[model samples]
Target: MPQQELFNNIYQTHYDKVHRLCKGYFNGHEGMAADATQEIFLKVWQHLDGFRGEAKLSTWLYRIAVNTCLLQLRKPATTKEIKTEQLPDVVAEEYNPVTDERLKKMYGCIQQLDETGKMIILMVLEGVEYSAIAEVVGSTEETLRVRIHRIKKQLSTCVQL
Candidate 1:
């Protein structure tokens, strides 16, 4: 396949998920997420020639997107919290109220997590399989299972508090 076709396939497949992930990392900064998403695609375009397929393509794209967002985060100017309500109102009629509320609460709790904890939970929340999460996080499935259990218990208690 041509590089453009490959890039288009990846972009179409992962854009929404990657955008949400970027939004989480940016704490709902739509502008930042948009910028990061573009940069991620750029990186993917540049690096596509060298992709040897050692890992799943989604994993590789996520690795790039995460790193890109983190790098943007390293800049002091990018650290301010943008109010989600103040964001440009796009077509959100499709957003389910209950799911949005849950996601907001979940992200609120997630903000308290340390980086590694946040990454693990984000992958899990994104519906990445436990086994795939283990690969992304570099731990055994057994260890991940225990950690996820503890994390959920902690969230349950914290939410109730």
Candidate 2:
């Protein structure tokens, strides 16, 4: 396959997953998540030629996504004020206050976690296999299992409060 076609194929295949992963990192801020997702694909395009196929392509893409999100978070913000009025209004068919409140609390808890913990738990919530997450996180599956258990326990306690 030509390089452009290969890059296009990989982007189409993994974009949504990468976007959602970015969303998790951004505390559900869709705009920030989208920006991060675009930056991740740019990095993918730059580094695709170096891919050695030692790991699954999805895993490589995910590693890029995670690193991109981390880099974005670490950058200092230039704009202090958010112009929410410029954003398009989102209409929902049905609204449940209870569920919304619970989700808010859950995200709040997630935001409080350490960076790596947040990444690990988000991947776990997304149902990424332990082996894959371990690979992406540079840890053994057994260690990830234990860490995930602790993260879940911490989140449960936080949400219940």
Candidate 3:
């Protein structure tokens, strides 16, 4: 496929997943999610020629996403939280519980996790397979599994507090 066509197809295939991950990183701030998603795709476009197929395309996109979202979070100006109430119907599950008190606590717990832990948990939450996640995090599957177990234990403790 031509690069533009390839990008469109890739965007269609992965936009929701990428957006969901970005939103998770941003604590469900939809605007930031949208902005980060755009920035991610823009970077992908700029660097499309560099993809050498050493990994699955999704894995590459996710690696870029992890880095991009982390960069967005690191920007001091981006700390201004502009929360709006317009949750996209497509991502309705993302804004669960009608009342958001519990959800906020969970996001807070997630945000407090170290970067790799945060990526692992968020990708797991998005239903990414364990092997794929391990690839993205550059860990053995067995090690990722152990970290997942520990992360879950930590999250449960954090959430219940």
Score each candidate by Cα lDDT. 0.79, 0.87, 0.91
- lDDT by residue (1-161, candidate 2, tens digit) is 98999999999988888888888888777889999999999999999999999998888888888889999999999889555643322546786768767977898899999988998998887778788899998999999999999999999999999
- Candidate 2 ranges with C-alpha deviation above 4 Å: 83-90
Output the number of the lDDT-best candidate: 3
lDDT by residue (tens digit), candidate 3, 1-161: 89999999999999999999998999888778999999999999999999999998889999999999999899888355465664543555456564566777888999999999999999999999888899999999999999999999999999889
TM-score of 1: 0.82
Residue 105 miss distance in model 1 (angstroms):
3.4
lDDT of 1 by residue, 83-105 (tens): 45553336586767777667667
10 residues in a row with least lDDT, candidate 2: 82-91
Q: In candidate 1, which residue ranges exceed 4 Å CA deviation?
A: 78-102
For candidate 1, what's the RMSD? 3.0
Clashes of each: 0, 0, 0
Model 2 residue pairs with clashes? none
- Once fitted onto the true fold, the runs of candidate 3 whose alpha carbons sit more than 4 angstroms away are 78-99
